[model samples]
Target chain A: MSPTNATPPSERTRVRRVAQRGRYDRETLHAIVDAAYVCHVAFADEHGVHCIPTACWREGDHLYIHGSNGSRMLKLATHGAQICVTITHLDGLVLARSAFHHSMNYRSAVIYGVFDIVEGAAKAAALDTFVEKIAPGRSREVRPGDINELAATTVLRVAIDEAAAKIRTGGPRDDEADMTREVWAGVLPLAMRPRTPIIDAAPSGTPDYVRQWHEIASANAAV
Target chain B: MSPTNATPPSERTRVRRVAQRGRYDRETLHAIVDAAYVCHVAFADEHGVHCIPTACWREGDHLYIHGSNGSRMLKLATHGAQICVTITHLDGLVLARSAFHHSMNYRSAVIYGVFDIVEGAAKAAALDTFVEKIAPGRSREVRPGDINELAATTVLRVAIDEAAAKIRTGGPRDDEADMTREVWAGVLPLAMRPRTPIIDAAPSGTPDYVRQWHEIASANAAV
Candidate 1:
């Protein structure tokens, strides 16, 4: 109902002005995370901490991420325990004259919360959501997962409670004194777009749903 | 020098199969980490573990990463504690008919180690390595960081003792039964290429170093 507040927990996570290069509102944050198909998830354990890049999808206000059920990290994350999920898209390299100022322009989101494992019907529903997230209407076009396959997968749900999004997009920021130096400086905008789809050797009947979905995705230049 | 033999701590952290993808060899691991300009760092505190994506570069077997020196995670990491560092390049998205089988093809490296604050000359050297890692030859082109600028930055050195690299390339791997299904399946290879260089408004002579660097980069698309 009310506007969802997506604020950083502490001053450390709060982005500074120079580092804050784009809109930090909730809409922008959700849009970037939802549009992305893969997210690099990082978490801590008794042996220290580790991060792995994996695929993720959003369903409503929550995000569902999965990995092999045997994964120790996934097993630990399943008890509705608090964890951190981060998704990032590197836009470009900010080449500054000074090494200290050399940086990257990127869009990233950090979600801090407890993730509950989805099982039974909820699990099936979550899997469907994952499919639809990639291809809006392709879920119905393919056969559903069997019990054996589902048993090997683990899905954890993280509610969007405490979160923050930071983005930097633009040309390099050269110092006034160094501005006249003979060096190249400008933004090379990085974007992802869907290329020509490779239809299977034998397609059922080019599903109307897929056709319409790709049409809209192409129009929006989304991969 | 003999190759550095640093084994990633646990079995889960150790990469399996596809030896090229699982570069446990120190030379290979350091090369990949040095070439990358950004890393997704994951750590935990009172609010749970969180992952923040930022720019990073390596010098020797040690990695240098920076952020607000006052950051909670940074402060925690500076205690010579272990943390997770991951760098990934999403080469392509593998779109499959069934959602359960859908996956992304990418190259990713994960490192776990204690981070210590680099001071004095060590800090300055790390900074130069950071610049050279990103642009190869740009460090000499610009003014180096002064004491005041260096004071404002917080640089942590993560030694490469426990690390692993995993990569997946080529077309999609659909199940034999699902292979005949009527759906699109293949890779959309992602590649990054530098566009025309935009020389700074004010300039010195186009440095031979810069020109030669571009030639080498264009010749090899490894980065």
Candidate 2:
């Protein structure tokens, strides 16, 4: 199941240079977007082209990102405008035998589509998704958004249209001759580990969600 | 001091919304670009707009990025083309008392400029900078690029030109009223850690530079 509601690869999101890195499988799209906490979104304004990095969350078929209603990017995105949202995860640094072949083992996705403003029940649900994405059970632990708080937020959803995932994994690929060089070449795994959460005023210790995230990430690092 | 050769925020690179976070300081530019291993470069063709995330290096006032000569992004960036390069570092998750004020602490820079193709020894030097950027002394340890490797690669340099660094640090900024809520709110520090190097074949343990980086990062996390 490539795209249940896939936009298919148009000229927009196609991975041209390293075509092999381009993957359109449904799982690839979900995995790339879900793993990353933020995305660099690009769009054109009268000032040529611009890219802004913002927090994002991936829902079932749609990706949700919200901002202050007064913000310019949110205003423009909600008007059914075209935009490009790209998420990248630097997995490891590939140190090739030759400087020219040095590459990053990463997973990135670029999705292009128009946005629609989500409101009412859907808006509240999307907010939960955003919090939960940060930590599995975070949404329930935090105070729910009140009426005025929800009113101040502007949530936009973009269908996972024209999606593409570019990934590079494993060890360096050096020329057979260069492979034997004495120079050390290998992978330095790059990862984001959750640190100790700093609470403002906790009558009751650190939250369970934060602690769970910390433990899982710590365990992974030890292994 | 600001841009010595500042591209001056054209309507293009100008930070319109939340203008307070937009910075034009020279040190800010160097700090952000130098810290990241990759950048999302955006440009337009008849096909549409594209953003390809690739390895990038900062040397003096010029930002260097290279890829296969056949790559479309490198092709467009080489010949005095207009492009946007953005780098973002997600520092933490700001769990606020209210959802409306939920924000992330991050540092991001968006640079706008036209590209110039680097040639001769400058191209080779830029590759060295790229490797050194990954690990301070990595270039010397790795085998130097051969003539064929340099010939096959295309390097582009964009002047520091119009650049803006938007940053949000510290803890959550919650509404005064919401501050008294019973909900747990705080910052979960997000950091990227370099894991142990997976060496290909090193007669003497890992190189000093790689081990140094790992130790410094590990020590900081312990603090």
- B65-100 per-residue lDDT for model 1 (tens digits): 876666666788887656889887776666665666
lDDT string, candidate 2, A151-178, tens digits: 9889998888677888899888888888
Per-residue accuracy of model 1 over A75-122 as CA lDDT, tens digit each: 878855567788877766666655556666678877777788888999
Clashes of 2: 1
> Each model's C-alpha lDDT?
0.68, 0.79
Q: Candidate 2, B30: how far from true, in Å? A: 0.8
For every candidate, give the share of true A-B contacts it also has: 0.41, 0.58
In model 1, the clashing pairs are: A180-B202, A182-B203, A182-B204, A203-B182
- Minimal lDDT window, size 10, model 2 chain A: A214-223
Each model's DockQ score = 0.34, 0.56
lDDT tens string, model 2, B90-180? 9889888766667888899888888889999988888888888787777887778888878999989887768888888888888788778
lDDT of 2 at B123: 86
